[model samples]
Target: MGIQEIAQATGLSKATVSRALRGLPTVAGSTVDQVRRVADELGYVPSSAAAGLATGRQRAVGVVLPVIDRWFTAKALGGVDAELRAAGYDLVLYNLGGPGGDRHRAFRRAMLRQRVDALVLLSLVLDETERRELQVSELPTVVIGGPAHDLRNVGVDDHEVAALAVAHLTGLGHREVAYVGGEDEAGFTVAVPYLRRDGFTEAMARAGAPVRADRYADGRFSFAGGVAAGAVLLEVPAPDRPTAVVCASDEMALGVVVAAHRLGLEVPRDVSVTGVDGHEYGEVLGLTTVAQDPEAQGRVAARTVVLEAQGASPGPLPPSAARLVVRRTTAGPCR
Candidate 1:
């Protein structure tokens, strides 16, 4: 049945019936119940497409991500999905394969088409062309990484998160710390890895244990990368070796642990290790880290975008808190 028929059956105006059916606050509770009952009796299935055409709203939120293979992506998507579903909205995911994918070209046109009501771009540094396009498009958008030119954003302060990890190591009386972070220097995202490295440097200097020139290693943020970099750090003479190391990600830290084991060195004895990212298994692995839940970050970003899409002027999203989780992988400096 149609909205008009439901309105006629309920003895109410079509506008009132529509608002009541949509659960708009303007409609009284009794009126909504009555409309729902009438709609139920008539087997009237409301057309979402018709509603979208009438209101010029798609009732969908687009979530853009850099990759879906990682654990963080899965957790973050879970948060985004739950939040959007609660708001009676659907999620349209767009996974840009990598930094320089030709597939991103499709989104440049699709976003301009205004297909989704709002968008949440995760871990992406928008290029000038895309930024210019999105700015003029006027789509309500929330970014899930660092500050994005005044856009609503919710993310862990990468610098502060790394600093917490460094502080934990230094507090344990560990000096001569090493660092393993990200894919090569040039492949790292604009603000992500650079800010993290900056934090490590600043925190080390504050604790009077500046990173040595040979202590830093660059590789992919992967287990294999960690193993390779960990070997380089451990291969140096015992007297000159760093007593502790900080990794930019959990996987990399785990790699270092594996490397240390293979080299017949006890964890936290030969070399303490710490990392960032709140991977669920960090506690199980007993790896000390500064945990920042990416899933929680996604939820905050979703809330901001959805509220703004519904015409509510929401303020900036709450910042993701950086938590220091102490596990067994870190300890006092090894002499």
Candidate 2:
């Protein structure tokens, strides 16, 4: 059985029956129910390939990511999946596989193919070649976690997120502070870490606690990286050491806590620590942090791209929100 038989039985045109079967918004609810009932009664199974050929839409969205294993990436992917599931759209994920992955080939071979109707890029700053390729493809695109040169993005104001963390620490009267952050090891020049680092510097300066030259260490945005950087910042003479530390991620903050423990320092007594991104481990470890919702950002990006792909004009998206979540890791400097 097919759409033709269903159409004949329902006394509707084949076009209307097809649209109804595809669940196009233009079809009325009652008409959709009628068409579906007829199709089911006739034991009709709709072919996705036939539908795609008929409508010139693949009914799928592509999500391109620099990596797949990070906490932010996983959460955001879940959000995109949830929104796409609701919209009856499929998700096609393209993982770059970290550093040395053939991004050029991936862009040319996988994305340029007519597989997905829209695209969502996660935290990638496209190069000129990549940008031109995207333009050539003419796919409706949305970015999450970082701003692309000319594309719409859905993520928190990273600078402001860092400033919130800085303000929280400074308000507690901590003057000497160290910073832990770094770029992606996969060699993608992500903007989030740079923005957060700049925000930390500016906020500290504004609070009259200008960061010292030696107080900065690259945490590499990983727990192990954080441990290495944390030791460099904390294993110092008492007067020379920073009284508080601010990390770009909760994973790094947790690493700092571990490094502190290894060095026989008591948190909030010998030194205080804070982080960004409300990682679950942060709660377990009682780490103060400024939290932003990556999952919500993902949902927004998916929804926006899907709408644009469907020929809907959406307005510029406002930046996502971030706020301070204080816990036991921060305190006033020791007297």
Poorly placed runs, candidate 1 (over 4 Å)? 1-56, 102-106, 183-188
Those runs of model 2 whose alpha carbons end farther than 4 Å from true positions after fitting are: 1-56, 187-189
- Tens-digit lDDT string for candidate 2 (150-177): 7888988989988888898889898889
Lowest summed lDDT window (length 10), candidate 1: 182-191
Would you list the C-alpha lDDT of every candidate in the order shown?
0.77, 0.85
> What's the TM for model 2?
0.82
Output the number of the lDDT-best candidate: 2
Local error of candidate 2 at residue 92 (angstroms):
0.4
**How do the residues 91-205 of candidate 1 rate in per-residue lDDT, one tens digit apiece?**
9888777666543433453354345777887766677777876775566788776666666677888889888988887788888899998653212245667788889999999
Clashes of each: 0, 0
